[model samples]
Target: MSKGVKTITDAEFETEVLQAEEPVLVYFWASWCGPCQLMSPLVNLAANTYSDRLKVVKMEIDPNPLTVKQYQVEGVPAIRLIQGNNILASAEGVMGKEKLISFLDTHLN
Candidate 1:
C-alpha cells in the first residue's frame, strides 16, 4: 500500500480486489470529473480511518476501462464495497465524510 491506500488497476484487480482477505472499498474515479476530485481527500481520509478494517483502493475509470466495465461503473466517484469477490454495497457520485463512514461501517465491520 502507498500513502496508506492501495491503488488497484485492471492488472491487479483479481488478486488485490476480488481475492482480498479483508473488505475492499474501490473508489472509481477520473481526473476530469470535478466531483471525483472533490471526493478524493475524503476517500483518503477514510483510508486512514479504516486502515485496519478495510483496504481502500482507487481505480481510475479512464485508465482501467476493463474494471469499470466489469464492475458496471457508469459514473465517476463511484464507491463499491466488496468482500470475497461479492459486492456488498455501492454508491454513485461524491460522498461526504459522514456518509462514507456510514457506508464503511455498514459493510466492513
Candidate 2:
C-alpha cells in the first residue's frame, strides 16, 4: 500500500512537490521521533486513500535542510497539504485517524 508513496529528498523537493501538477501532501518526519514512527502508517494510509486527489510524499527532516527551513518546518511529524506555492492546510504532531482524514479532505473537494 505504501509502495505507492514516494520517499523524497530535499534535492527532489522542487521538481517533485513544488512543481507537481496536483495537490501534494508532504509529510515531514525524523527517524528518531517516536511519534513519527507511529504516524508513518497513518501517513501511508492517507497516501493510498487519497491517491486520486493527492500526490503524497514523505521527507526525512534530519537530512533535508533546504525544505525544512524553506517550509518553516520546526519539528517532526508535520504535514503540509499544498498546491504549487500555496499551502492549503497544515498540521503538527500526531492526530487521530478521523481527524487526519478530515484534514486531507479540507481542500480536495
lDDT of 1 by residue, 1-109 (tens): 4336677789999999888888888999988899998999999898888888788899889888998998899988898998886999999997788898898887876
Worst 10 residues of 1 by lDDT: 1-10
Which ranges of candidate 1 are over 4 A from the true structure? 1-3
The global Cα lDDT (0 to 1) of model 1 is 0.87
Name the top TM-score candidate. Answer: 2
- What do the candidate models score in CA lDDT, each in turn? 0.87, 0.88
